[model samples]
Target chain A: MEKKLKIVGFLCNWCSYAGADLAGVSRFQYPADIRVIRVPCSGRVNPLFILKCFQEGADGVLVSGCHPGDCHYQEGNYYTRRRMMMLKDLFCFFGIDKRRFHISWVSASEGKKWADVVTAVVEDVGAALRGSEKQ
Target chain B: MASTENRSEKNTRRESIEQFLYRLLKEGKVDAVLVPKRHPGGNIVSPVLISEPSQIKGTDPLAPVQTVNAASIVKELVKEPVDKKIAAVLRPCEVRATIELIKLKQLSDESLLIIGYDCPGVYNVKEYMHGIENREDKEAFTEEHIHDFLSGDGDLVRESCRFCTYFTADSADVDIAWIGVEPPGIIVAARSEKGRRMTGGMNTGDKDAPTVRKETIGKIEARREKRQKSGIDNLLDLIQPCIRCYNCREVCPLCYCKECLLEPEKMGYTSERYLSRAERKKQIRMPVDTLLYHLTRINHMGYSCVSCGICEQACPMDIPLGTILHVFSKKIQSLFDYVPGRSRDDELPLTTFREEELSEVEDV
Candidate 1:
């Protein structure tokens, strides 16, 4: 059997974490690859945390927060938006595969969307790893 | 007019600057002046805080060497609200870094007067020391450097300085300009109201800086911009030699964190944790997280990086950190239309955010 790819998911407590919980309650099937870590808000996800995930041999990382203007504590995800964009740019510049890292918005009501985001991220991370191995 | 002519009569630019500083002290315009001067027996030039008037001799602001970015020293001098004003004569990069420090709240400029100068780039410390040792008249080497710089011979300066666009003090209160001036005399041009107040009685030369100075600076900037287009593409390979000495962080004026996450103790690695990490990878790099350290640092401080090249200067492995960080920070700063050290009013990129900006970063 092939070893399982470890994908770290940081979900904001009020929105994304609730969304993931809702997905489980509704029996919405998604990839089992992600190991979810609950965070207070998406803004709590430091860029260092994402980098540390990669450094610790995580195959991929996903950060999910509330939609802009929908934060439990207003404007947390807004700052996260700017920080993640700069981090993504820096990662690309350092030759890190940009596809392996992902960011999305999944609100408490969006259980189906949470499932979709995970499935897509798992597929992307798998493809990216396979592509790198061939090279 | 007599003082202007007398200044021109001085043998070298160093003597004229010394005279001006001496007068500033004697006239009690400033309580103390922080300027770079050689140590008692060594050629290494470092920032010295001189309160007495007679101690201004041997002070060389135009020295083509920077052992440490003087902003760090300025931070120490004015960490608390100071009662007496001190004038700091600094290079353009130092002035920019000082401005950033002030904005970051790492420094208090309450009793600080910044006097900036037109820089003619600098050699790395080793090259500068070698040149000074070979030269009989130490002052003559600076004159030779200026002459070479004016004539477009920038081959000898450090790589960062060669491609530096901000080689003059546009943001400084009072600028001591020597580039493109006739007869090699310094021009003291006050750029701000505070600068005007500070330089009210001082007479270095004609207050109106020549039009040629702007044109010369424009030419150098254009040349540097062209060189900057081909930035360091292989940054990972370039930083491979980094021994994790933290020299870059130590020397970076903007890296004023009292508790750094990059410290080994902060990582809290145990013997079993190390073994597990190696087991997981089948093998692992011993001094782990070198890449992680660099990336995290850039994320934390890239917005505020002044690119003084002091980090590059302090690197033991001689990594091209200055050029890499300069190139990286330029991109990051441009994303938010933020220029570090450009002004005091502009908010740091990470500190403030606009409601309707960066919509592309969020995936719906």
Candidate 2:
């Protein structure tokens, strides 16, 4: 049996988490690679969380938040977007593959979009893992 | 805008500064003066707190070596309110760090006098010590170093100083200008009411700042910008030798967290967990998470990093930690148009958010 790639998804409660739930309810198909952890808001996701996931052997990390101006706490997603973007740049500078860590905005109403995003993320992460194995 | 012109025509630069400080103490303007001084052995120079005017004899505030950022010392001294005011003579970096500390509530400005000067930067302690080992008068080291640096002999200075643009204490209450001025003279300009009050009795003459100062500052900034651009690419390579000793965190003036999350207990690692992690990774570094530690600090202190570079001095591995930090911070701070230690009124970037800002950072 081959080792399974572990993808950690941090979903904001107001939008992305609900979007994930809606995907399940609507019977949308997506990869089971991602293990979702629902946070109060994307702003609550510290940069340390992504680093910790990587350190604990996560092959990929995805942070999904409410769209700008649609945050449950008014501006949490905006802060998250700024912070995560900077963190992504930092990871790139650290020589980590940019594909391993990702951030996106998915509203609660977009269950189909959520499935598509997850499918794309899982594929990218799986590709990265395969590339590393060959190396 | 009270600027102090050179009062004495014959005194050397060091003598004039000493005289100015001596008078401040003698006239009872400040209860104590915190300045660097040569030890009785005449080898090392360190910060000293002198209450009496006569005790200021060995004071050499312009030494070309900094043992530690005096802002941390100021934090300790001013943690409690003092009955009498104390004056601190600090470098540009120290002044900026003190300002950041003041905003952090770690140090109070009340009953405290901040006197800062134009800095030519300092040599690392070991380098300075080695350079001055055969010298007869260690007191002349600062003047000699300045002359050499201005003459383009910069190998003696620390790497951080070579690329430092903030060579003037723009944030200080009182700033002493000397970079482009004539020798044996310094112009003191008071930026705050407290500074004005302290210098009211000095009766020093006023002179217009020569335009050469601006040109000199611009040249240094251009050089630094060039150096920084080239050095940023090797940041990961520079930090690869990190032993995870956490010396950088300990030496940082802005890392004031009493309970840092990087601690082993906070990281939640069991004894067996290391073995398991090593098994999973095939080979785990003995002291793990060096990159995480650096990133966490950069995130925590992004807004407060004064770029003092004391962390680089403390690193045993000789990593140019300051350059790495400054590169990241300059980018993040520009995102918010924020400069740490610019002013007490300038809100920290992490604490405040504007509705229509940072759209470029978002994925829409």
Candidate 3:
């Protein structure tokens, strides 16, 4: 049996966070593995913050901001994308599996897409947990 | 053994020192000489800028073990208007660090005529002092031990000097490069117009001997071999004796921080917790940051470690800080064709953003 993996997700309030809230109102079911922290803009995440979370033992991390040009702050998601891209590259250099982290462009209106992304990421993290245990 | 290269230019350091001072004083180029002068006390020497040549003739090239990084000094000087060019005899690392400081806008090239040396390596103040303190005549003990202390076959060099590969001066406006070829002097490879112009009328000739450079490299490698396993053991060992003291920063020539991120009064510093319950009270200041202290300084100036080996020399506990610095500098600079301090203008990889760099990227 795979142990429950604790996943932390940084969801931008205008997009992913609102979409997550909509999933609840729409009665959609997703895995409870993720604990979401809402931020005004995804660009607030620094690589140091991510490294700190990993160092303090988070099994998986998901960062969902608005779609590329659809940031509530107009350019916030674009900046977040570049920073997270660099952060993931750093993690890969340390031999962390790509499957353990997720970044997506979910919009405020895309509640169904948010539910689908959560289901997929949670299952992927669950599978990774199993694989790491065997090794 | 005194490097055989020391003999050829028999009066090279002396001549170069005289020419630089003459240019600075007679031509009004610089205000002073920021080097160590010896006192009768034997162990105590301080960083002073000599305006008069008579004052600098007493410069203890082997004693005082300079801890003030000439790199940071150049940076400080750059802040003011250049009333005159200040010719500084900096270690290769300090020269490179000065170039970097200039590049970083901390220093200006106009105010400095960097006189760099082919460093044979210097001793930690404490260790050299101990050797002196244990002997009958402190000055004689230091003079006698300079060879044994720096020689690889003799007592181990300060760990910083052992791992450093750039003992020769490769970059500087004006260099008395330790060609490490024959003895008593360097072959003087003029890499810059400033160096070439300075030695224009001299009998300085080309080094047709490739074997000499290779031989010097062979000596350096022999020392580097003994320096292995020192990197890991040294960094881990720094946890003790570090005491979170910022003395290394104060002594370091490159560690110029008007407002450092590590200062507790800066408002962002978080209090650290210690693992040992018995040692908890002793850990309040948190050994400040063994990793960040190394990492941030490297980030800020990795491209400039001239391998001066001063950071380790200043460590109170004798931590081999310079070895760890060189390790990271070596790994980081391999990506850029640019070796730190080798050039005054190479842009740092981290500081510059490239539109087409295609640097390491993770696959989706």
Candidate 4:
């Protein structure tokens, strides 16, 4: 049996956080491996903050915010997306499993998609973990 | 050995540089000239822009030490719609800083000329002067006296300049290489088109600065050898005295941070990290990455290093910051065949990234 991965989900209150709440209200189910931390905005997540989560025992970290242009603080999510893209690119350039970090946009109406993305991210993290242990 | 020029000639530094610029100002060769002078209070000095030749009387070209990079200010000075060219008087470092800023598009070269001088390193104004001794003893030093006063065989120099190399200009448009200690005139090395063109008129002095250049070279090499032996430990010692006072960064001519990303506000540094004595080591927040900031800036801008020692001159701890930056800059330049100020056409390493680089080095 494979060990369960501990994934951390940082959701923006304005969009993804509410969307996750809606997922629960809509009875959409996903793996309980994810622990949600509510942030006021996605732009509040600094790369160092994400790295800190990984260092503090989070096997995976997912940042879900409003779509690029729909950021509550104008270009907040856009900045997050750009900086995250650099981090993701850098991680992949190194040999780190890029699947460990996922960034997405899910509005309040996207409860089904929210469950689907979270389920997919956890599944990928579990796959990477098993692959790492085999070595 | 030939030009026996000597004396505390009645001519102030104002007269020498301005006398040269007077003709240019009259000939419309330059639109403006930027230099520094002892302010009205007779103590603090800063770089100022001089437009009229008549107003050039207050200029001091041979200030015993300089604390600012006048080159960045020159870039700022030239932003106007100039009808003609502008000439800037830069210590070797300031000139280099100006060129780096120019490459970054922070400055324009459309109508700009540089007059770079051999830098006789300056005091960290607050530390060596105000912090250690009397304020009115300003008369105690002179540039002619530097090679003697800072011989280091007898006494420590103002720690910063003593450790710095590039005390002379290798990259100025008009290099005002000082000939010798006595007369204190310069051997003008012209490496640019504008420099050669403008000098077509003046009865300029010959190149005697390099005769002293060998001695300067010897002194600098010895310092480098000693620094290489002791730099890491020397750097480790500075963390104690460094009060996180951004004086080094603030006074750095090149540390032009519109919003310094390293600021606690910007980096989101918190106070609780230092709660436990043992925890300090785990998260040493003491001016976090102070060394890295200096190193990165050097890596970022050193190749174009004008050899101006202003960064060292600015550190309040009297950290020989410029020496470290120059060391890295020198090493990287040798590694990559890059020399700052050799040609404006050459691309800076940070600006250009090759896809195929390090393929040969991968096996090593």
TM-score of each: 0.93, 0.90, 0.70, 0.61
What's model 3's lDDT at B81? 64
Predictions in order: lDDT: 0.84, 0.80, 0.62, 0.63
Candidate 3 matches the true fold with a TM-score of 0.70
Interface RMSD over true interface Cα atoms for each candidate: 1.7, 2.6, 6.1, 12.1
Give the per-residue lDDT digits (tens) of candidate 2, residues B83-161. 8899999998889888888888887789899998888788888988898889875646667777765545377687778
lDDT of 2 by residue, A1-135 (tens): 545668999999999999999999999998888999999999999999998898777889999988888999988887787677667766646656778887888999999989998888888887877887798
Q: Report the lDDT tens digits of candidate 1 across residue range B126-212.
A: 889988886656666777787777766457688888888888887888888877776457888777778778778674654445789
Each model's DockQ score: 0.59, 0.39, 0.18, 0.04
Quote model 4's TM-score: 0.61
lDDT by residue (B270-356, candidate 3, tens digit) is 333234422543433444445445445555455455556677776677666676666655544554456766676677555553443
TM-score of chain A of 4: 0.93
Give the per-residue Cα lDDT of candidate 4 at B138.
31
lDDT of 4 by residue, A1-135 (tens): 656779988899999998999999999998889999999998888766666576455889898888656778876776566446545533432245777888888987889989998889989888878798899
Question: For model 4, how does the per-residue alpha-carbon lDDT over B245-319 read when each residue is reduced to its tens digit?
Answer: 666566555555577655756544455643552274455546565544444455345556654556666556767
Per-model chain A TM = 0.97, 0.94, 0.93, 0.93
Task: Give me the candidate number with maximum lDDT.
Answer: 1
The order by descending TM-score is: 1, 2, 3, 4
Q: Which scores greater on lDDT, model 2 or model 3?
A: 2
iRMS, candidate 1, in Å: value is 1.7
- Candidates 1 and 2 compared: the better one by lDDT is 1
Write candidate 1's Cα lDDT for A8-120 as tens digits: 99999999999999999999999899999999999999999988888778999999999889999999998898899888877767766988999999999999999999999
What is residue B185's positional error in candidate 2, in angstroms?
A: 0.5
